[model samples]
Target: MKWYFVLACYLLAPAIAFCNSYGMGLTNLNLAPTYGKIALFVFSSLVGSDGGVIAGLAACGIIMSIVCSAADLMQDFKSSYLTLSSPRSLFVFQMICVAIGCIIAPLALWLFWTAFDIGDPDGEYKAPFAVIFREMAIIGIEGFAALPKHCLEICCVFFLAALIVSLLKDATPSHVSSFIPIPMAMAVPFYIGAYFGVDMFMGTLILFAWQKMNRREADGYAVAAASGLICGDRVWSIPAAVLSILRVDPPICMNFRPTSASV
Candidate 1:
């Protein structure tokens, strides 16, 4: 990891990340982020403490963006393919979006950065993840000795479980395997809560019901309908975030609670 080589990597990282990350999905497992993590940890280990912390932070951010972009692009491509869109056209569209994102993302970040003390531990927001990620880099440099009690063991156990599940899925027949829950997908609920899982289950039920009632119509427009609903819900968050940043509360508030506090 020479300075010159690292510089070259920065120049070619997007292309390299896209290929390795997306190509990995086609080959077997789609652990795009893991590749980025390995690069971060290994690079951190090779550098001194100050350099490791600073460079590792930069590397972690870049790796995350690149790997995440690749995975997201893969999903977009899948949606396009399902909708009978051309790969060439999708690729061109993606490039254009990437160009726009390159400009917009930085400006949005700059706006937020100016508004909030992002890395400050004592700031209003107190970005705890900054400390966590930095600590991860230090651990990379310090080796397993720096890990919390049972952290290494837990990680190893989960890694093996994911591997075995992936193996079983691949070995099983397609009919049977489709029913097999993806380890990565299953892992999401453990950390993020089962609200999303419930949503997926309900969506699946609706789709199945729709197909049973009218298979042809469901096949034709189900994705578009689902995509529109999801996009609409997500798109509202953009303005909601902007309003919050500007310290403007919404005019209306609604909440459903199981119990209300007595006045």
Candidate 2:
């Protein structure tokens, strides 16, 4: 399985590099889904039910990586074009970062799992994304009709609301539209916990204030600052997990739940 994963990564690297060179976007690419289906069939045939599940997961991961890399590479290409930077340099740097991530991500996950119970109902980290993925996989295998009627109805409501909001955003003047909440932003809290949405709202409020105070410097620094915040949050999790494993908690309590006594 490890060898197959490595082989797939090796094969994908050149394909991604070729696509990036041609400035081709993956938005309309039908190749990934086809490849995924083929992989699913092959793995299922080679192993059994277990292999089929593994293959499905592997295929999903591969497809996601390809799509994400395509988007990131396209953005990098556009940025390079605007700045008159070397595409070669950008590609090299991207590959270096990718290699570093490949090494670091598994290590971080291992540390996290070792330090604390993941997917625990009463644990701080419930692994919501994992639950979402598992449910999605079950739906994929059982067919959309197998999903609960209430869930389907909720989805329809969100979809219709999003459509209306999208139309309004298109029709409204830019200044007015900018103030309107995105349908996705409004809907996400229903699926994910409210704390995640709170972080997003805080970030949005900070950016809004920054732009209102000085539009010029905001344009230059807002993206960099936000990117740093996002990356720092993830990077800090590694050390925090390490501290947890070492039985050394931070001086300040980062997690605070409201208790009846406090109330």
Candidate 3:
């Protein structure tokens, strides 16, 4: 199933490239950091398994990789389910949304580049997928042999850290498990560490300032702020909110599942 999805991505690569180049426009600021971790995970897993050097290590790396990517999607999904929205509908909506965005993105890029003609006169536009693939290759070359050692370190650190935190806070084991990966990813990767730190601090500050308000109210503010940032205009406020909802993945796998889910 996973391989099929990967193959499908390749099959649709041309369309995705065209969309990115011509339709919706592209910006390095937002997309680069978001996709970087994703690429790291993908590449690390693939490269780690190349020689079948360490079965256990490879397996753990793959799991961490999935957890890393899923964390990003899960946060957005969590926000979506907070409001009234159907889970199945939101899932389908994301599929359609990404398909459209991937197809139109290239067209948007071409226009932006042509308008500015600033950076590369050669019209060299690297699509998101290609960038991801390149990063994966780089990760493979760097850690292909040392994969087992790395994987052991990751698993040990992940569970031990989670356990320590859970014990110290009197939280459940599941709570620790659910919350551990995001911070773990940040620890090794400097760029991701900085970004997550900033984002978490901002979220904490917002929640602290709005301490008197209910969760629902704070959620509303966060959603509004996120929407405004994403849409670039108020006309997209509603749709952005809807997109936020659509992106939320159910927390069937986690203990910290938002209390707001209806389905």
Estimate candidate 1's alpha-carbon lDDT, on a 0 to 1 scale: 0.73
Candidate 2 residue spans exceeding 4 A from truth:
1-66, 77-139, 184-195, 247-263
The local lDDT score (0 to 100) that residue 159 gets in candidate 2 is: 77
* Per-prediction TM-score: 0.60, 0.49, 0.36
lDDT of each: 0.73, 0.65, 0.49
Better of 1 and 2 by TM-score: 1
> Whose lDDT is higher: candidate 2's or candidate 3's?
2
TM-score of 2: 0.49
Candidate 2 residue lDDT tens string, 1-263:
34675476557645654543333332212234333443444333343444445654565566556655665777787679768999999999999988998999899989999999999978999988667655445444543454577876886887798889979998999999987776644654654568667867898899999999999999888867977888888898899899989999668776576685552
**All candidates in order of TM-score, best leading:** 1, 2, 3
lDDT of 1 by residue, 118-176 (tens): 87777787788777777777878875566589987998999899899989999999999
lDDT of 3 by residue, 6-81 (tens): 4533454444333222211211122223333333444455545553223322333344333333343444455567
Candidate 3, superposed: residue stretches over 4 Å from native: 1-83, 92-123, 126-155, 163-191, 212-263
- Angstrom error at residue 76, model 3: 7.0
Model 1 lDDT-worst window of ten: 21-30
**Model 3 lDDT, residue 118, Cα:** 38
